[model samples]
Target: MSSTILPVSELTPSAAASEAEDSGGKHPFLVALGQRVRDIRARRGMSRKALALATDVSERHLANLEYGVGNASVLVLLQVAVALKCSLAELLGDPTTQSPEWLMIREMLENRDEATLRRAREAIGELLGSGSAKASARSRRGSRVALIGLRGAGKTTLGSMLAEDLGFPFVELSREIEKFAGCTISEIQGLYGQNAYRRYERRAIEEAIQIYPEAIIATPGGLVSDPASFNLLLGHCTTVWLRALPEDHMARVAAQGDMRPMAGNKEAMDDLKTILAGRAAFYSKAEFQLDTSRQPLQPTFLALREMVRNALQMDQTEHAE
Candidate 1:
């Protein structure tokens, strides 16, 4: 059985709105939803017929959905989202749209001074049981430490050392993401797009948290770009920013036999500098900051060991209290 294809003209926002109006005051939300579905399906390069087959919906019904004339059930929407390999939220609204929790927070902060609002937000988060706040508190009582920095900042090396010294598991988050995606990070980005990569990154973090309650995590450099996943990291792990000069970062990568940093690129160092500058604000949010630039590896290792030891001691004290 062949499915009906929606005409380009019928898929337009104006046409969708008219169709909604003609349907006896059916809400315009269906039009928006249909558009969203069509856009995502197109982006994923899935044909409507393929999607319909995967989602167990008729192609004719799917055409009506794309034309913003069908009233799709929640179950149908969910199945479509599953077929498209996205969250229901992603299908229903923009990914960056502020959630209800954020809206409530904005309203609560109205007319408040910065300092007062900060304190009030903390208190309210604790009172209303904010997941990030609660996770942060739990992190202080647990044994998870995440190292954040640019590539070649010694996160993997130092994290492995610290984990071995402390008798805890060491996890590289990017590797976990690749494992979950059943491919390399590069492959994931190439095959699924950056948004999908971010989704996998979040899922990898969540799984790591569950699998290794007491572990050292070495995170990807761009992990901070995703606010939700970064917040989850900040809330659940004692983060340390491993700092280094751009020149040193370049030198280290070259030393590791990965000339990709400078290969065929005269402006690689400049690009590194720009990236570091852009991410400095986010990296500075870590509870601990350690500079590993222009120092011997052994001395840097010693300093990192001391920092981790102190942090663990502090965590123990907080738990005891």
Candidate 2:
């Protein structure tokens, strides 16, 4: 007996062509589908061979599928979804699209007036409760505080100070990421690509949380760009956003004797400002916010120290009750 291979023409030719056209030649549905499969598999720490074996598909075919050129059958896709432990809809849907729950919420609010929608949103928030309540409960039992900010925002300096004050370990997430990649962050990005770097970043955060459940962690500035990893960070650690003015950020970076920010670009300040603006919304999701611009180092440190101490004490009191 011989096995039969399906051709691309047999796999819904019209639909594929329509998708390719809709994407304006940037990425067809199949390519996006393959990328989604690869990302999910990476997050689960599964190899292509493992997925192939689980799906009962040949390694070569699985490779083609991941590469976004395979003309996979519906049955094959279903098997792949099952093997990846995800729904078929997830495998086939847009990778960048919002989750189904958010989409349904949007649809439900589409026809409502602004006032009604606002009330509904408030009710939903009240019913679901704040993420901070859950975080406070966890903080009483675990001492994980994650500091988030841009490069020159003093995350490393302040994180070390806080860790020492609290008698907790301090971990720089970038260093962990480098350790996982077996090279520097720049080298990892150059070698494997940005997506691969993010995968390593996510894995590094997971490992860090597992290893140092009671520690202060300094995270990369752009970690929030990846929603899934950022959500994991928020869920596991009590996050603090250390903020500063754009000028202070630039001055601090320069004070460190690292001129890389202005090494090749005359518009480095403009770029930095743009990056800050883009990430401000995500940074605001942190449990606490502290501004570190233009203040004396001693004063800022003391304030942060006192704030953290109070927060921890409050959590402990709540737990006692």
Candidate 1 lDDT for residue 317: 74
Model 2 pairs in collision:
none
lDDT per residue as tens, model 2, 220-315:
999999977886787677788999999888888989998888765658988999999999988987879899985878788888888777866776
Question: Roughly what TM-score does model 2 have, to 2 decimal places?
Answer: 0.65
lDDT of 1 by residue, 242-314 (tens): 9998888898899999888997575888889999999998898678999988588888888988998898788
Models, CA RMSD each: 12.9, 13.0
TM-scores, all models, native as reference: 0.65, 0.65
Give the total clashing residue pairs for model 2.
0
lDDT of each: 0.80, 0.77
Question: In model 1, which range of ten residues has the least summed lDDT?
Answer: 1-10
